[model samples]
Target: MPLLFLLRLQHIPLPVRVALSEEVRLVSVLVATGLIEADFAPVRPTGPDAASRIATVKRITEEGLAEIAKMSDAPKFAKTSMRFARGLRLM
Candidate 1:
């Protein structure tokens, strides 16, 4: 769902969307590893309010990171993945 939304965001090209998706997945992993809290709530963009929409996602992501940082266990989260060949093809 989030990936689809990322794909549709106008200012963000396909590569950027892919990067953001990977970041989100890493965020999810951190949450799963007890390193942060995940925002399970969905973000629905109504119109052309790009700034607000981007801010919404960024805020939630930052907050989740903060929550994880406060945890004593602070597990090492995995990094985001990339498909270099696929990205090259897209380019």
Candidate 2:
């Protein structure tokens, strides 16, 4: 699954986060399922007055990490990453 692959790239870019842009549909699914928690900040992408807001991922829930750990294609260390991921902050 995308989420599992996403987690695998945590250290790839030298920091956190797998992707800079995420589809709204996928984000909704992840949020609704309690896979991750995020905070939305209003952004005026089109104009200064635009009320549009963008959300950034804060962290992945323990349950979410467990879900990743169960993935078949996940890294071999995925199962043992729960503790390390618990306090991790996703940007």
The whole-model lDDT of each prediction reads: 0.38, 0.56
| TM-score of candidate 2 against the unseen true structure | 0.49
Cα RMSD for candidates in order = 14.9, 13.8
How does model 1 fare in lDDT? 0.38
Alpha carbon deviation, residue 72, candidate 2 (Å): 4.2
Q: Mark the regions of model 1 whose C-alpha exceeds 4 Å error after superposition.
A: 1-19, 43-91
TM-score of each: 0.27, 0.49
Count: clashes, candidate 2: 0
